[model samples]
Target: MSTATAASKTWIRTSASIRAYLQLMRPANIVTAWADILAGYSATGLVMSEQTWPPLLWLLLATTGLYAGGVVFNDVFDAELDAVERPERPIPSGQSSLKGAIGLGIALLGLGIGAAAQVSELSLGLAIVIAIAALLYDRFSKHHSLIGPINMGLCRGCNLLLGVSAVAEQTQMLWFLALIPLAYIGAITAISQGEVAGGQQRTGVIALLLLSMVTGALFGLSFLPSVQGWNLLPFTLLLIGLVFPPFLQAADTPNADMIRAAVKAGILALIVLDASLAAGFAGWPYGLVVLSLLPGSKGISRLFAMT
Candidate 1:
């Protein structure tokens, strides 16, 4: 090939490589991770404050690394499985190399920990825990029917706590709030199991029940004295509206495609759930700010898979 032709081919190869990595990172799901931090920070009543950007920005970056690392490792670990069940995935389809995916995962995880360390020891510790939980789910727990969902949930819960670490006292007092995401993500994970092979109606029903409990908790939290002025009802109702139809449909159909749709809706609805939490703690304005991420997340989901 001539010099110009060779250079053009090299540029095309580089562009394709970049797109493959982005696919491995699942950018749309990473947006939901940022929502976790915002919701937790809002609970500290510091989301919109003047000093918010410094720490909040770090946490957002940290979650980008953590969530991206977790999902990348997921694809890495499942490369063999993907070749069999999802031959179109980056690794299986030869769009991304396995060795490069491993390197990317390690670097992103280190970035997650390093960014959190810049915030505080508490944030660092939570970031470490989140990383460990993510690895656990990716490597071991994800294979277990009972532990897989809970392990994934723990990663998300600790991510929320990483946000709370911005305020030491609030972190101590409000750690229990992490359980809400735990249950919500756990239900999503459960629904995800059916995404490949199809799941039973019983599994979908269980997920719906768990989601209902999560909604109830969100509504109850809004009634607390500290959040008395802001109403979480609108956000909570929005969450219900976003998630329920697909969830119910999946329960009725229980097919791989329908289950996948339900899982996608659940994952996207997570941003709405985080918005409700933010609005409940800080007020509707901040809640709307968090909710604003949804449009971008949804748009990206169209290009990159969210589940």
Candidate 2:
């Protein structure tokens, strides 16, 4: 081949490979991790100002690395299953190697903890704990019906705390708030198991409603005074609109395609959850910034898998 032609082919190959790795990290899901960190800031009443920059920046690094690593490792562990169920995935399709995924995951996890260590001992400690939970969930507990979703939820809950605790001690209120995402994601995870084949998911629908009700209860009580002038009713409505619409759309049939739709929606809806929390607890501007990620995440999802 001509030199230019050869270089062109090489560039194409490299671009394709990079896209595959990006799919592995699942950028849409990563936005949810960003929400977790933002919620942490909101929990501690840290506004989106210069004063909050240091810890917020570090926690962002730590959570992203840790969350990305956990996801990468999940693919590593699920390679065989994906081969059968999702053969188009990067690993089984040969777009990326198992070894490369492993290396990347470890690097990200290490980067995450190291970033946390830059913040404070408590942050480092929480980062380690979440890392352990991620490892356990991916390696051993994922197949367990009860343990899997709970384990995943714990990772998210700690992620929120990882942000809050990075700069200051977590209050009892923050602890309570963390459980909202935990319950939401855990319920969604429980529903996702049937995505491969799909079927009636009445229980999943009910679970979603119950979780929403719980979150609504918290909003109703006005347990926070961090953000002002954001109406509770409208915020609650927006939260429901952003979060439950996809799941509700899929509820009628719960078939494979619909279930996949719900699963993907649930994954992206994490940003809405985060935005809702930030709006109610931090400020509407913070919530708006978090919500703005939705478009970018959607744009990326078109190029790669979100779930």
Candidate 3:
């Protein structure tokens, strides 16, 4: 072969490898982590000013690392299962090596915790707990239908708190608000368990109920003395517009493709849900910033499956 041909071949191989790693990380799903950071800021009633950027950047780094690391670790642990049920996945498809995936996961986990530590001791501690919860879910909890959802939900809730911990005051409301994501994500994860084949209608109903709790909580938050003046109606309506339809459709038809679509809708609409929370506690402007991620994530989703 000519030198140019060899060089082109090498470039193609390198590009393919990079794509595999990105797939392992599931960047579209990872974008949802930004919800945690903004919600954390909202919980604190902190305005989005220039000074906020420094700490916000740290939280973003921490959340991105942890969320990406968790997805990578899950892929690593599920490699054998994927080989059987999902042979096209990066690890099983030979595009990404198992050893490489594991190494990247471990590195990202450490980088996440270390980055949070740069922000504050509380953030670091929360990051460590989040990492452990994620690891356990990947190793053990995933097989147990009930525990798996709870574990995943808690991880997301911790992601929110990881951002809250950056604040000095750490209000009780922030802690209380964390439960919304916990309930919502837990329910979503439960429903996702059946996406590959089919899920029970009961499970789908329960997931819808869980989502109700989160939305209801957001509605109630509008009544709070701190957030009384700003109208949260638009935010709530937008969330319902984005999230409610697919889940309702999934509840009626619990087939493999339908459930998977439901799962993907839930994951994608998470930005809208998070934006509602941000708007409820903070203001509409910050919520708009969170909302922007939804369309941006569509680009990521095209590159790889969010599920």
* Candidate achieving the largest TM-score: 1
How well does candidate 1 match the true structure in TM-score terms?
0.97
Better of 1 and 3 by TM-score: 1
lDDT of 2 by residue, 240-264 (tens): 7665766776676777787778777
Ranking by lDDT: 1, 3, 2
Greater lDDT among 1 and 3 belongs to 1
Which one wins on lDDT?
1
Report the lDDT tens digits of candidate 1 across residue range 257-277: 999999989999899999998
TM-score to native of every candidate shown? 0.97, 0.92, 0.96
lDDT of candidate model 2 versus the reference = 0.78
Cα TM-score of candidate 3? 0.96
**Model 1 spans > 4 angstroms off:** none
Query: Clashes per prediction?
Result: 0, 0, 0
> What lDDT score goes with residue 271 in model 3?
86
